[model samples]
Target chain A: MRNMAKGSFKVQVLQAREGAIVASVNRLLAEKGYDAMTVDEVAADVGIAKASLYKHFTSKEELAAAAMIRLLDHALAFLATLEAQPKATALERLKAVARWTLQVQLAGEMPALPAQNSTLRAALAANKTYLDRLMLVSDKLGEWITAGQKASQLNRKLPPELILYTLFARACDPVLSLLKAGGKYSDEQIVDLLLTTCFDGLCGHAKLRLA
Target chain B: MRNMAKGSFKVQVLQAREGAIVASVNRLLAEKGYDAMTVDEVAADVGIAKASLYKHFTSKEELAAAAMIRLLDHALAFLATLEAQPKATALERLKAVARWTLQVQLAGEMPALPAQNSTLRAALAANKTYLDRLMLVSDKLGEWITAGQKASQLNRKLPPELILYTLFARACDPVLSLLKAGGKYSDEQIVDLLLTTCFDGLCGHAKLRLA
Candidate 1:
């Protein structure tokens, strides 16, 4: 009984340590970006030695992949929560996702890393686990796009892939953080403005009337 | 008379060599990006020894800066050409610039380089030659935006900076090339669709006229 209890305690402690390392990595990636981040820095941030970080993930590539996978999981989980909400329209869900994305970015919880690192891009491409989750989220959003189009909530002429890319663009939408940090507008005001600019079109009623 | 002719010929040759170096750097920066591009490859591409390349630009940063300054010059020059054209509306001139930018990117001439290099960013920020041209273009566009709003062609609620950034966003707009290259849409079709998307809202009828 004693041995079992000791084993259980060890497992829990290992899980806690792993979680800590991932959290630290996410924070670093958000703050400094992937190209500038190093394994030793993540290890040091987590109060673990470099070797111990290697024990968790053998390489910086793997560490970054793991961090990205965790984010994907969070995204999927957010979608699930939205799904559980009763009678949400496809457009509502998309706005929810966009809102959540903005909130994450504002909180600095997002790994707002650049997509310029070839090695990291390759790692992500080869990552079946990450790739699978990414594709799944993609499909979910694609469904909304199709549904919205059919319901005439979306422009039928506009391609779904284009919509997807625009949403992805919002992640790095420098305008969000720029406006928030500029202190010219409140956070809610900024979010509302972006949502309007993104969805309802930037043209005033006169231009809209022509279309 | 012969010696004077030879000296003038030598000066022309030197100018050509500098132009070749700048062109090669731009190509490499586009392909491998700034972080991965090397001086050795640039020297080889320019058909010059590494020493010769260094003689022209003492460091890689200087070489990159020269390439960027050259691009800014191209943009300013294009704006100048547009200014010479009479009877063009603000929107018409804006669209002309947008088309020219897209054409440059399609021809593989536009430098949509990612912002990964802090040193390059610092250099650009301090670069009076580049900043002067950038600000001139920006101020000119800002005037058009204000006029566009006053003329009821633009959304007055949206700030001028947002409009300016939206147009600038096209230079780096990944969707334009990605969808075109995806083979789903022809270049002409892609450009038209993107142009429409930019000026008008995505909603074909606008203002939630889903029916």
Candidate 2:
């Protein structure tokens, strides 16, 4: 029993260390981006030896994938909270998800991965954990999107894939950072303005107001 | 007279070579981004020795800045064409510019720069030619945005800076590439769909149509 208890404690410590490493990778990736971030910097940020980090994750690509997986996990948790809100419409839930993404990006927690990095793309594709979480999130969001469309909340003329990609694209939208840098608006205001432009569009709302 | 002719011919050749170098840099920056792109690759792509390339532009950042300047020049030229029309509304002209930016990006002519790179940002800031063209384009676009607002063609509630950044953001929007990658839509269809979303928005148009 004592040996089992000691083994459990060791596992918990290892998990905690791995979590710390992933968190550091997430922050560094968010700050410098994947191309500028290095494994040495990540190790330094985590206050661990490079060899120790290597033991936890084999490569920078793996570190990135781990960060992405963690992000997806957080996203799934957020989705669960939205799912529990029984009064929210399908479109409302999707907007909430988008709002959450923008808020996270504003808070400097979203890892800014390049959409066109071949090596990193390959690594993400090969990562089972990352792929699974991504698919799971997509599936959940997909359900809400179709529901939104059926309820005539989202545009039925647009394909579901387009809507899905647009939502995913919001996580790294440069407009958030640009507006944030402008310093004229609060974080809530930034998200609200972007959310307004995003769903209602720049001209659409104006036209509607006129009509 | 003979010496003058020879000098003119030499100048034309040098101009052509510099243009070729900037073109290669633009393509490399689009394909590999700024961080992954290297001087060696740019020189190799341009079919010049690294030393010869450096003789024209002193640094990689200069090459990027030159490409950006060229792009701005092209934009200014396009805006001039729109101005010549004189029949298009400010909103229509703005939409045309957004479409052109998306088309350039889809054609892989857009140079993708890191928004947070201090060294490159410093170099660009120091570049008088780049800054001048950027301001020229912004001034032209700013006119249209305000006109659109005054004419009630754009959302008055949103700031002009938000509209300006939103249009600029469309150049690097991931949704354009994602839809392109899906291979289900033609370039025109992709541009049209995105333009629809940009102006009319997802929720607003569907609601308008339903109403």
Candidate 3:
């Protein structure tokens, strides 16, 4: 029983250390992006030795993948909370997810990955945990999207994948950072404005309503 | 007179070579983004010595700035042509610009820049030619945005900068590449679909129109 207890305590400590490493990697990725962020910087940020950092994550790509997996897990948990809110419409839930992504971006927590990096893409594709969480999140969002379409909330003319991609695109939308940099609006206002454009578009809302 | 004619021919050849270099840089930027694209790669793509390429553009950032300047020039020229039409509505013109950007992105001509690169930002800022062309393009688009808002063709509640950023965001919108990668939609279909989402949004157009 004492050996089992000691083993459990070791697992917890290792898990905590891994979590701290991921959190540091997430911040560095957000600040300098993947290319500019070095493993040494991540190690320094985590206050750990380079060898110890490598013990947790084999490569920078793995570090990024871990950060993404953590983000996806957070998103999955958020979806669960939204799922519990039975009163929210499918479209409302979709908007809430988008709002959460934008808020994370505004708070400098969203790691903006380079879309064109094939090596990173290969790593992400090979990482089973990342792929699983991504698919899980995609599946949940897909359900909401289909429901929204069925309820005539989302555009039925557009394909479900297009809508899904649009929502995912909101996570790295440059408009959030640009507006945030402009410093004229609060974080809530930035999310609301982008949410409007994402849903309502640039057209006159009154004109569309009147039409 | 003969010497002067030879000088003119030499200048034209130099200009053409510079154009080819910029074109190669543009394609590389689009394919790999800024961080992944190397000056050596740019030189090799242009079939020139790295030292020779440096003679035309001092640094990689200058190469990127030149590509952006060329793109802005193309946009400005397109805006001029649209201006001459005189019959296009402000909203229609804005949509045309957005469509053009989307089309360029689909064609893999759009140079995707890193939004968070401070050094690149400083280089671009210090580049008078790039900054001037950027301002010119922004001012032209800003006019259309203001006109659209004034004519009640765009959402008045949203700031003009928000609308401007939205249009800019469409150029690098991941939806274009994602949909393209899916191989389910034709390029024209992709552009039309994104344009619809950009202007009308993700909401049911029928509901908005019927309302």
Q: Which 10 residues in a row give candidate 1 chain B its minimum summed lDDT?
A: B202-211
In the range A127-163, model 1's lDDT, one tens digit per residue, is 8998998899999899988998888876787778877
Local lDDT at A126 for model 2: 94
Ordered list by DockQ, greatest first: 3, 2, 1
Stretches of candidate 1 exceeding 4 Å from the true structure: A1-7, A177-183, A204-211, B1-8, B204-211
Report residue B83 deviation for candidate 3 (angstroms).
Answer: 0.6
Model 3, A1-211: lDDT tens per residue? 5547457777889989999999998998888888889999999999999999989888989999999999998999999999999999999999999999998888889997899899999999999999899999999999999999999899998889999999999989999889988999888878888888889888838332223
Query: Each prediction's Cα lDDT score?
Result: 0.76, 0.90, 0.90
Clash totals, every prediction:
0, 0, 0
Error of 1 at B187 (Å): 2.3
Please provide, for model 3 over B105-160, each residue's C-alpha lDDT reduced to its tens digit, 9 standing for 90 to 100: 98889998998888999999999999899899899999999999999888888889
- Every candidate's CA RMSD: 4.4, 2.9, 3.1
Give me the runs in candidate 3 sitting further than 4 Å from their true place: A1-7, A204-211, B1-7, B206-211
What is each candidate's fraction of native interface contacts (fnat)? Answer: 0.34, 0.77, 0.79
Model 2 misplaced regions, further than 4 Å:
A1-7, A206-211, B1-7, B206-211
lDDT of 1 by residue, B1-211 (tens): 5546557777888988999999989877766667677898998898889999988887887888888778778888988887788788777888777777777766776664545456777777777877887888899888888987888777777767777777776776676766766898777767766666666644444322223
